[model samples]
Target: MEVYSERQRISNAVEVLKERQLTVGLVPTMGALHEGHLALVRRALDDNDIVVVSVFVNPTQFDNQDDLEKYPRTLKHDVALLEEVDRERILVYAPSVEDIYEGNTISQKFDFDGLEYEMEGKFRSGHFDGVGTIVKRFFEIIKPHKAYFGEKDFQQLQIIKKLVEKNNIPVAIIGCEIYRETNGLAMSSRNVRLKPEYKEVAPFIYKTLLAAKDKFGIESASEVVKWVESQFSKQDLLRLEYFIIADTNTLKPVEEKTNKKSYRAFIAVYADDIRLIDNIALN
Candidate 1:
């Protein structure tokens, strides 16, 4: 696998690949490779002749400065793991902040309609705008045939799909299934930041979501949310942020299930100061 730290250099390299008539697949990620990240790359390898993974913990995406500073930077370890995926046909684009936002460095505003109104968007201000900015930039830089993302960040995935639709971007967007630990914790790079004892407690977010899913079939969305809140209350370390059953497409909170549509239970919990988010299909 080859690595490039500059946008122009990688653009030149990908241009050469395009001249050879090779189809390109992209899996954009922040450094610190985990099973979840590799899942995206693995699928990209299967679908395209060449795959490119961009590993930049974009500074613009973090709403909290402290959180941004705390974000992991494990590029060396990440590249080593990608080498295990494929020694050839894989190009790793690990660019610097200046490499991406050269010159004036102004961030573009993205209008995601009502999609940014609740949940993560409500909590983390300007987060999706940052996401839209970096993703739009990557689309221009990589110019891949397809790009892959994970369902764990369902809201972000939807926003990206909408971004492409809104801008008429040519690449296809694929949302891979959420990769989880055997114990059911949704895989996240932030999982590395969890306090050791809290790590064992983290999987309860998924377990509670699983229970909430089953309850959704028999109870009202509000009732199911109360049950989930109660479950989290039992854990001293887990602080429930918000629990809501919402329409997958609109992302508006749902009071009850409708047969004609699909819904998901989205939850956020803070365990020993480490925040974790997970969701499950309710329909």
Candidate 2:
């Protein structure tokens, strides 16, 4: 697999592919290639003539400096993992911060029609702006026929869809299923930071969501929220940051399930210092 760091080199490479009428699929990632990331790339390879995996850890996305500093950067291992996926079709664009942002690492502001007002957007100020900034940059640079993103970050997926719709960008945004461990823990790069003991209890986060899903229709949304909070309160290390059941489309907190719209249970938990987020559709 060939890897390109500079923007011009990859743009030139993608241009050559486009001239031959090749359909390129892009998978934007922050490195630390786990099974979850590879799942996206694998699907891209199956769907398109060429797959481009951009593995740069974006600094603008992190609200906390410590979190950004501690975020994993495993480009060598990442490339090896992608090599295992496909040696020829996969082009790894592991660019430097300067290469991505061009020395201006600041994030751009976006209006997502109140889509960025809750959940992750509420907690991490200007986070979606950073996501939009980088993802849009990639869209312009690579000009892929399609882009793949995981549904684990459901809110971000919706925001990106909005980004394309509003801007008239000609790329199909595909949201893939959430990849999980055998025991049900949602795969995340932050999973690498969890201590052995923390890892043992990490699966409980998914278990609690499953139980909450079971209680979703029977109990009121507020009642289910309280029950989820109580479940986390019993654990010493795991702390519940926020739990809300909201309409899947608008993402507004819903008090009752209606036949008009779909809903999902979104949860954010802190396993010690590591923050994990997961959501399950409750229809």
Candidate 3:
């Protein structure tokens, strides 16, 4: 895999690739890659002639300084994993903070309005803006024919799709499935932070959502919420952040009157300060 730390080198490499008429696929990621991230790379490799993965821990996306500080960084392992996937076809661009955002000012910010203000957005203020800014920069730099994102971050995926449409960026945004472990817990880099006991119980998050989906059909939203809240309340080790069934597209609280429509049960919990997020769609 070719590694480029500077913008000029990356730009030149991309230009050469373009000159050769090779179709490019870009997978943008914050490092500490896991099976989920590799799944994305594998999919990209299948679809395009050249695969480029940008691993930069975006500073702007984190709402909490401690969370940002604690965010995992395993660059040596991440590169090894990429090379294992495909050494010849893969290109790794792992740049410094200064290299990415050269100037102090970033002009573009995507305002998703209602979409931005709900769910994860509500908890992490200006988080999506930071996501938008970095993603836009990466998109511009790579100029890939297609870009891939994992469906685990469904809301963020939706927002990026909207950004591409609104901005007229000429790249197809592809979302791959949420890769999980044997226990049904969605694969996430943050899973590394979990305590041994908490990691074992982590699969319960998915199980809870599955149970909640069944209850959604027969019960009111309030009842469902109460049941979910009680489930976490009883689990003394689990620190429930938010358990909500919201409009899949809007991420807003679905009214009881509108319960007939499709909804998604999204949950974020803290087990020993290692936050885990998961969601399940309901009809």
Candidate number of the best lDDT: 2
* lDDT, candidate 1, 110-226, per-residue tens: 888779777998889888888999999999999999999999999999999999999999999999999999999999999988888999888888988888888889889888988
Q: lDDT of candidate 1 vs native?
A: 0.91
Q: Using lDDT as the measure, name the better of candidate 2 and candidate 3.
A: 2
State model 3's lDDT. 0.87
* TM-score of every model versus the real structure: 0.98, 0.98, 0.94
What lDDT score belongs to each candidate, Candidate 1 first?
0.91, 0.94, 0.87
Please give the range of 10 consecutive residues that has the lowest summed lDDT in model 1.
Answer: 103-112
- Against the true structure, candidate 3 reaches a TM-score of 0.94
User: Which regions of candidate 2 fall more than 4 Å away from where they truly are?
Assistant: none
- Model 1 steric clash pairs: none
- Tell me model 2's lDDT, rounded to 2 decimals: 0.94
Q: Mind giving the per-residue lDDT tens digits that candidate 3 earns over 1-283?
A: 7888987788789879989999999999998999999999999999999999999988888879899899988889999999999999999999888998885634356776568778898888888898888888888888999999997888888899888888899999998988999999999989888888999888888899999999988998878989999998888778889998888777788776374567888899998888888888888
List runs of model 3 lying over 4 Å from the truth. 103-108, 257-261
TM-score, predicted candidate 2 vs. hidden true structure: 0.98
